[model samples]
Target chain A: MSSPDSSLAEQAKAGDLEAMNQLVAEHHAAITRLLWRFARSHADLEDLVQETFLRMVRGLPAWRPQQPFAHWLQRIATNTGRDYFRRNRIRDRWQAPLPSADDAATATQPEAVEPGGDPAARAAAEEVKHLLARLAPDDAALLTLHHLEGWSLVDIAAQYGWTVTATKLRAWRARRQLRALYLSVTPS
Target chain B: MNTPPDPGDSRWDDLLARARKDQPAPLDLAALQRSVSLEARRLASARRAEAPDWTALLPFRSLVSSCLAGTCAFTLIASWQVWQWWQVMPWAQWVVASSGGAP
Candidate 1:
């Protein structure tokens, strides 16, 4: 849905302070939601959202507002989230839990599911996100935009800088590969 | 309740929908706006400062400028020499004509 922030967008484009403030205020939640899905970890959420806004302001001069302002801003958020992970991948791995000696000795054992409400649902969600993280960055972004964000093919195409047909074709390929990837990862 | 949604199928849409929860959000962006905008402006200025100078686009820019300065200096010197010759030419001709006629 197109956000009703066009007037603010127009004024922000001109560097109007009040309009920019209102515009950022208006779009923040949508930015958070977009980045939340796009982020590989919850820890990166705040930084990613902040970077998105910074990029939006940096890009304001070039934003013509022919399309919805939310679309433009969300595109920046998506890119920022992806870029944050890409840049931090090595650091993230470095920070990952080192396998303890006891854990290493029991490697062949079936892992104990963490105690939580509805282990099945939690496991499924965790698996989904894990599999999502394994997908090629573009494929993950495509799925998140199309499926998670419910963005239209046209919106996806515009925001991702692809033609409609290209977006469709790429999404098709991504989904197929993701299905295989999912099946391979999750227990039957 | 069943096997997880089939990827590449409509079932996956349900999984995606559940992931969002799609709550309507009215966020407070004032503090964030101020901070991010200030940082953005700072970065923009820094980027502008780090940006290449217009002259840097040309290889040997300083050499070209120096050549241009030398060309201007030569032109001015040549013009002055021509003006001096022009002024002295008629006088020399008149003196020759007068001296020849007197002799």
Candidate 2:
């Protein structure tokens, strides 16, 4: 996987326009997922995804091929989203509570399907997203990647340049904090 | 494979699964690809724009840009004035008068 991504990245860096387009399409879904993990609303997701690719274009010239392309791309996407939140902090504060994910979960949910997309399932999804929104950005992202995406502590730590022990400790604390919040919100 | 959860354990896994199911809205791949292409062009143009213009031949890019801009402005103004002069007095009539023909 890294080999192909690396080759594609190399071509893109060398100004192969088709290869760049292919790379954009190839990584779009994963980047979209990563954006979804942090973003509260789905309204501006396409713009965010577009911004992610745009930043990738700007950063690809200075990219080192030693590290895997996906990792580098993910880092760039994370930074792009972080910058977006930073730029929009005041606007977001003035805006109404985000209703996209939660409302979407409720609205699109089908009746009589006990699968992962049923109403209860979406409600659970809504709860988790709401919980994530309540936490700090870093904590929210860590939990989303680890719990939702099953990224290992080592992998998460590697992305953040933290020791595995530190990652584990932080994840534990974050999970406890999440649990307390969840219990407070969800009545037994 | 369905892993059975112990009775006492919290069911966060199911919730995690549900969260994972709540995907972001589907994106238009064509639009993204188009944006990527557009960005490539934008970057190329920006690079070209940032490149020092050879005509200025000056070490400082700002001065070069300004000089080039001034040259263009002067050229445009000069061109417009010349056009106006030609409109007011035809060069052919001036040539006839200078050659001692009827003006």
Candidate 3:
């Protein structure tokens, strides 16, 4: 028997609006959670989630039933997150103030910290974002998926359509870069 | 030579752990649904706008083919006229006289 998601996907591809909406409703929270790490605020999170679903709907015709729907959605969400980072980098280059070494050192003290969380965790998260912002978008995404999301190299490779060996090399390099950045920004 | 410590090593776990603990705020499901619906509608309308209207081009279909055919015929006729003109030219006569019409 075909899975419910496969069935829903088939209907959605056939232009069933309800099926599309159902798929969105079912996966909205998961996509939001995945993209939250990439977002700077609640509004950005919402926008990313919306973009992910829009891409999903647009891509329904190309989705194969052999692949799990959730996995496909996850890939789309990851890609959406990567695109968000790329756009942010471009915007930061033009509009945002240039971050000085001192600012990098004190990045943990983000002004727009989300209210009502474990302050330490929030600060750490902010620090992580700052460090990630310093790296290339692709490297930051690779580190986020592998380190923060606890995804294995093989899984990340599969999602990114890269070979396991390549993924391993990239992950190693990204980790080393992050470590260097962290050391530079951290006070002795 | 000493190798630098890996960030994936145990020492960096504490920071990653703390980062993981920073959960996202609860999403407004209704707002998300509304946004998706609006985007979907916008995309549908955009796709509709992009779709080639063959029917609208129906009137021009014959016009375009006629224009193409007319241009081809004009080119062929012009080429034939030029060939005829070349055959009767003074240069043609000279070339024919020089080569004894073997050319």
Candidate 4:
């Protein structure tokens, strides 16, 4: 919950390499994880992180201390992730073939090892991830920030500059959709 | 009797634990630090070498920005003026008569 300091921002703005390194270390994992989940590919993680940090470095000179640096950093990170998907959308579409039952099983189901995997659980995870991929980036982001990161609704609302009610509503709808996807993928 | 935590209930935690167990040995922090320092020095040198001659373009960039701003301001003001005139277009002759024929 504690955010980075203005002194750190100022140092990075002045091109302090140590400060830049510290900033990256502080937030890069969260950003990378978020992007990776959305991307469904680890290959995009490094590029997205680099782009986000580069933008942060460039925009540092104009940054004001009035806002939480995390929020601003997250905005940049999210936009960079979204831009990555947008640019490679077509290629990614061609590359990521439809999820097989096995692929779905591997990606979802909480990494439980059984004789093979509990087909039902794998089906559940795949259905969820597939449905999640179809969601708007904002919706996907909110869901991940809440469920995966275990962040409070208020924290997510503040981070994204959304009203608490709106965030909750979107999250609720997203969960419902994910459940529906899981059910649909289950062999009745 | 202390009950064991259900493995099924904590799959994510279990997976994370396995992942940590599978990771390679700890990185050499000192070596990493040295490499980072070296990269930093190289980046700094590169930046200095690629420094632009901003002094030469400062005047031109400033002038262009100022002129564009002024033109935009003028256009806005002119549009507002025309709009106001169109809204209350009293005849010029009638205005003169109302002012007692300019005495």
Q: Which model scores highest in DockQ?
A: 3
Which candidate, 1 or 2, would have the higher TM-score against the true structure?
Answer: 2
Please provide, for model 2 over A37-121, each residue's C-alpha lDDT reduced to its tens digit, 9 standing for 90 to 100: 6665555567788888988998899998898888898987776665555545546567865444335435333334322234555
Q: Which candidate number would show the highest TM-score if scored against the true structure?
A: 3
Question: CAPRI verdict on model 3?
Answer: acceptable
Model 3: per-residue lDDT, tens digit, A1-188? 88999899888777777777888889887887788788777678878988888888778778999988999999999999999989988898999875865787566674564553677777777778778877788888887887667888799888888898887877777778888777776665
Name the lDDT value of residue A30 in candidate 2.
Answer: 90
What TM-score, computed on C-alpha atoms, does each candidate reach?
0.64, 0.67, 0.77, 0.52
User: Which of the two candidates, 1 or 2, achieves a greater lDDT against the reference?
Assistant: 2
Candidate order, lDDT descending: 3, 2, 1, 4
- Residue-level lDDT tens digits of model 1 in A59-151: 887887577777677778877866765665555457775343343323322125332233344333444555566556676777777666677
**Every candidate's lDDT:** 0.64, 0.72, 0.79, 0.58
Clashing pairs in 3: none
Candidate 2, residues B12-75, lDDT tens digits: the string is 6667767677666568899888888988988888778765776456667888799999999999
lDDT of 1 by residue, B1-103 (tens): 1323347455555555555553222333666788767865676677777646644665587788989999999999999888677656757677668879521
**DockQ of predictions, in order shown:** 0.20, 0.24, 0.30, 0.04
Task: Sum up the clashes in candidate 2.
Answer: 0
Model 3 ranges off by over 4 Å: A96-98, A110-116, B1-4, B8-11, B43-52, B60-103
* Candidate 2 wrongly placed segments (more than 4 Å): A81-120, B1-11, B53-103
